[model samples]
Target: MGLFDGYNIASSGMGAQRTRINIVSANIANAKTTHTEAGGPYKKQNVVFEELLVNNTKNLNNNLQETNNKNTSAELRGVGVKSIVENDADPIMKYEPSHPDANEEGYVAYPNINPVVEMVDLIEAMRSYEANVATFNTHKNIDSKTLEILKA
Candidate 1:
């Protein structure tokens, strides 16, 4: 691993966590939404992450076999958000006869997003974001220290 690898990894984690926070916020905002252009209630959204691998040849002008054997370097570039997937699960139905969005059967549709779940996810996302920030700060400190030492 290289010195800058920490920054790359932390930034990736931050991006992923930021996406998660955005999705959770959207879900919470639309929790009570009973009407959407798509149809009934709003659907909950979640983020997907994928690992990133670094590939580079350490030795350039060598035989194929020798190069392959010599190049044993790998680095974690960062995480990427695959997609923001909507929950296909059915929405919770509430008996709200007087509600404006109520159906003919005297029931209103509500988003599948549960407040408890959204809150938990928000907390996790915030914590992950904080962790990434701390990691970035640590890397910055290390880089600063290395520079100071080099000047000595």
Candidate 2:
């Protein structure tokens, strides 16, 4: 690990959580959308998070000493958004005979998204983002104090 690796790790988490928040917001915004340019209702989107691993020569050797450790030798590097995917579940079907997008059977296809669920996801994402920010700030404070102590 480098001297500033902690900052990078924390910032990566923040970025990933921000992307998650954006995806949740989009899902909520299109919750009631009954039609889209894709020829149907908008599909709810989700963010997939991935863990980044770093191979630090020294760290790897140290971690390898713990033979019983489950993680082996890979060091946790950062967080990343692996992908954003649309929900494959069937669309919500509603009987709306008068609606323009209604099927011949008088049922309209609404995006299979619930506002309450989206709101909860949004809150979770926001909280995660806040936690990352706190980590980053703590790193900054530690670095600042280290510099102050060094100057003395």
Candidate 3:
């Protein structure tokens, strides 16, 4: 890894966490929504994260040669959002005869979203984002110190 590699990794994590936060917020906002453009209740959305891999053959080869180790092929570059998918779980059906979106059986299909769970997920994402920011700031400070020493 390089000196700036930490920044890239942390920033990617921040981006992924931000995406998660947004998705959670959206799910929370649409928790009570009964009608959507898709013709049903709003579905809870989830952010999927994946490993961000960079093809740095030069770096990989150099490290392998230096260490005389050939077991590892690549390095974990960073994190990224793989996709945003709707919750596959069935919606909660509540008996609300007076509700406009209620079915003929007087059951309304509410989104499969739990407010408490969404709030917890939101807090987790926020904490993860904050941690990534701290990591980025630490890397920045270290780089600044290194440059100052080099100048001297």
Candidate 4:
């Protein structure tokens, strides 16, 4: 691991969380949207995260193993967004005979999004981002103290 691996790990987590928050916000905003350019109700977007381990495949086992050996070259891992997917849950249907987008059955289709769930997701993402920021700040403080000790 490099000297700045801690910072990189925390930054990657923060970036992933930020993207999640943005996506959740958009889902909330479009929760009522019944139609879009895609010709359907707005589908909720979900962020899928993956662990990032930089280096050749040879180092994979070493990274996953517990290291009693301090000199081991096991790299510091980070979080990354693997993909953003649209939820396939069926659209909510409400009876509105006169609504422009109403079906032949006199029901209007609304986005499958639930504002409460989106808000909860938003809070979770914000908390994760805050945690990453705290981690980054701790690393910065440790680096600063190390420099001071060296100067002394």
Better of 2 and 4 by lDDT: 4
lDDT of 1 by residue, 1-152 (tens): 77677887898799889989999999999999999998888998889776554233232323345435756543445676867888998989999999999999999989888899899999999999999999999999989999999999
> Which portions of model 2 show Cα errors greater than 4 Å?
54-73
- Clashes per candidate (backbone, < 3 Å): 0, 0, 0, 0
Could you say which candidate leads in TM-score? 4
Prediction 4 global C-alpha lDDT = 0.85
TM-score of each: 0.84, 0.85, 0.85, 0.87
User: What lDDT would each prediction earn against the true structure?
Assistant: 0.83, 0.85, 0.86, 0.85
Compared with the true structure, what per-residue lDDT tens digits does model 3 show for residues 85-116? Answer: 98888989999999999999999999999999
* lDDT tens readout by residue for model 2, 1-29: 56778888888899999999989999998
Candidate 4 runs further than 4 Å off: 55-73
List the RMSD of every prediction in angstroms. 5.7, 4.6, 4.8, 3.8
Instruction: Name every residue pair that clashes in candidate 4.
Output: none
Off by more than 4 A, model 1:
54-72
